[model samples]
Target: MQELKAALERQALAEGFAKMRVTRPDAIPEAMGRLRAFLAEGQHGQMDWMAERAHWRGDPAALWPEARAVVMLAETYTPEADPRAATLLHDRGAISVYAQGKDYHDLVKRRLKRLGRWLIEEARGRGSAAEIKVFVDTAPVMEKPLAQAAGLGWQGKHTNLLARDLGNWFFLGAIFTTLELPPDAPETSHCGRCTACLDACPTQAFPAPYQLDARRCISYLTIEHRGPVAPELRGLLGNRIYGCDDCLAACPWNKFAATARDIGYAARQGSPPLAELAALDDTAFRARFAGSPIKRIGRDRMVRNVLYAIGNSDDPTLAPAARARLADPDPAVAEAARWALARLGIAIVDNPDMPEP
Candidate 1:
């Protein structure tokens, strides 16, 4: 199994994975309890799926009874520049560094499948019947905890997996296999007293040092939550349109994280003018973000988020962008437009269309 493990690591690297380690299916003993508590407190917000699949996600062994090992891998997508700089561009909408490129689900999963197939072939050649399942973020899998269990990284105080060497910019992918493998020692948190990630959140999403309240998170508000965001938090959203990267970028470990090797992870969707984004109809939005993860959020949600960004932009020049969406078809988009207009101090008197700032 040690030889197989070595071979697997080599194959994973060849498949473009940054790091790979093996762990027992039941390695993450505390995952179920933490997940239960997080759900009990309603911290997941609109993501009811977490509660729905708690049984499987809490225990990887339970997800697949015969699985003897969880092969955790990291796929780096570190941004070439500071993502926070884009958030400061008042007229532009800031997309998270991860989403600025192709959807990682497609990218990582394809590589995982390739690696998994190689593992099966290599194991059978050694006279072992190997059964496996590969999973990205979409599956009912607690990858961060499992990654920590495999010694790939520890879950930082911000609740994302960050390696001392790999920083905070990698994606996690899992391959559960029936062939027993040597498990790596688990990694413990190195965050210590550092509050870098906690202090950088624009919406103060962190309830405490390590706990997160998704309901108040700008990433969740912009991407997950439907309808208009809470008025108080709308202004706090600033220019972030897709997802917020403040906490991740704030981590000191990022200094060691290398930029992405795969050109597909490059920033093809750099910050665009809020006016341009706000005007995207369904077809245009779909075409613009065809291979992007942003496409999943749909045109109305994107426009709704753009209007919110416009509201928080503070630049009066972006007012027309918000004003035009006041009569948008989607109730949420229209509401966001009105809020943006009001935030800019442009009174929407009798007409749904506001004059100017």
Candidate 2:
């Protein structure tokens, strides 16, 4: 078992995992309380799934009694260039670090399976048949808390894990194993007196120091939310078409973070011109975002998000792009595009005084 643990650590590091830790399957007491309070306050917006699996999400052992230990892994995927730098060009869209590359869900899961297979093989040789399962953000697991507890890092004020060495720009995955690996001491929080992330949110999603209201989060508005964004928050969203990173990029501890090693996760497609994105048809949308996580939202919702971004672009040239989308086949996209074009002063002269429905 000792040899297995050592070998697992060696192989994990060799496989490009920045940090790894073993943890007991336990509920994070402090985080559980915060989560319960957040859910009770209805801060999760239309994401009812967070509330649906509350019990299991809060407790790891309850999720699977057969699992004896948890293997938490962190992969750093920081971009070489500043992710927030492009946001200053308000006419251009700002893609979050996580979304700027190939989907981490698939990439992380495949590597985790390799790690798990190694663990199982090593355990089997030592007279134990280990049952293992790898998860990347797909389950009802409270991954952030578990990652923090596993000593990968402490949860930052933005409620995401941050390591002194890895920073907040990373992907988290876990392997639930039946082996009893020795657990490491957890990391401590260091977000003392820092309100940078909280203050930087465009929509002020962070209601308090550590609390987040997903309803107002631009990441949710552009990615998860399926319909037209609230008119009031449209301008605030800026040109972040896919996801928002105001809070993540605002963190001060990211100075020591390493650049991404896997080229597969690098930002491609030139940050995507807002005007071009608003004009994508269904086939073009799928082809462009193929193998990317953004495709999950489908063409209509994706274009709907782009239209809102166009409205916030503040560039009259983008007005024509939004106007072109006004007749989009999808009603949701058409309506949002119409709203954008109107806001950009491209509407018919007769409808000059009209407001968006």
Candidate 3:
């Protein structure tokens, strides 16, 4: 089992994974209690799916009773340049580093499938039967806790997994197997007395250390939340049109982080001009974000988010782009346009009844 574990680690590294570790399916026993508490408090906001699959998400053992080991893998998608600099360029849209290029779900899942196949062949050669299932972020799997159990990294104060070596710039992938692979020593929390991530949240999403309120998170507001964002939080969004990376960028551990090795994770055009992104119609938006994770939000939601950024930009030059979206078919888009015009102090002559910001 130890020999197979060593070989699996080598296979994972060769397959472009930054790090890989193993843990028993029942390793994260405390996670179930925390999950229930989070759900009860309605901290997940509009992400009701978290509550729906509570049993599976909290307990991996229950998720797959046959699975003896959970292999957690980390794939680094660290940005080449400082993501915080994008916020200063108010005329441009600040996209999260993770969504700046190719969709990680596609990239990570493909690598996981390849690794699983290799593991299956290796097990067969050893006269052992292996049945494996691979998962990226799509499943109800509690990857962060599982990763910590597998010694990948500890959940930082920001509630993101960060290590002494890898920082918080990696995406997690998991492989549940029937093989009872030897587990690694669990990683202990190294984020002692660090309040950087909490203090850096634009929306003050962290209610306490290691606790996140998704409703106030810019990432959730921009990506997951459908329809209009709450007026109170719109101004705080700044130039962030997609997911925000303020907490991740503020991590001191990131000083040790390395730039992504995969070309697919590289920034496409740095920060795209906010005016140009705002001007994109459905067809144009689809073409621009093809193969990118941002495409999942669809044109209306993307445009809506862009309008909010334009409102907060204080760049009067972008008012024209926001004005063009005033008559958008989606009510949310039109509402966002009105809000932007109001913020820019641009009088809406056509829509006399447009409300104040």
Candidate 2 regions off by >4 Å? 349-357
- Candidate 1 wrongly placed segments (more than 4 Å): 351-357
TM-score of every model versus the real structure: 0.97, 0.94, 0.97
Q: Give the local distance difference test score of model 2.
A: 0.82
**Candidate 2 structure quality by residue, lDDT tens digits, 168-257:** 898899999889888878888989999888988989888777678899998888888876778898888777888888888888888988
Worst 10 residues of 1 by lDDT: 348-357
Candidate 1 lDDT, tens digit per residue, 12-76?
98889999988998998889999999999998988999999999999998999999999999999
Alpha-carbon local distance difference test for all models: 0.91, 0.82, 0.92
**Ranking 1 against 2 by TM-score, winner:** 1
The pairs that clash in candidate 1 are none
Q: Write the per-residue lDDT of candidate 3 for residues 1-357, one digit (tens) a residue.
A: 889989999999999999999999999999999999998999898998999999999999999999999999999988876799999988988999999889999999999999999999999999889999999999999999999999999999899999888889999999999999999989999888989999999999999999999999999999999999999999999989899999998998988885677789988847889888888888999999999999999998988998999999888889999999887878898899999989999998776544433
Q: Which window of ten consecutive residues has the lowest lDDT sum in model 3?
A: 348-357
Which stretch of 10 consecutive residues in model 2 shows the poorest summed lDDT? 348-357
Candidate 3: list runs displaced more than 4 Å.
350-357
The alpha-carbon deviation from the true structure for residue 290 of candidate 3, after best TM-score superposition, in angstroms, is 0.7
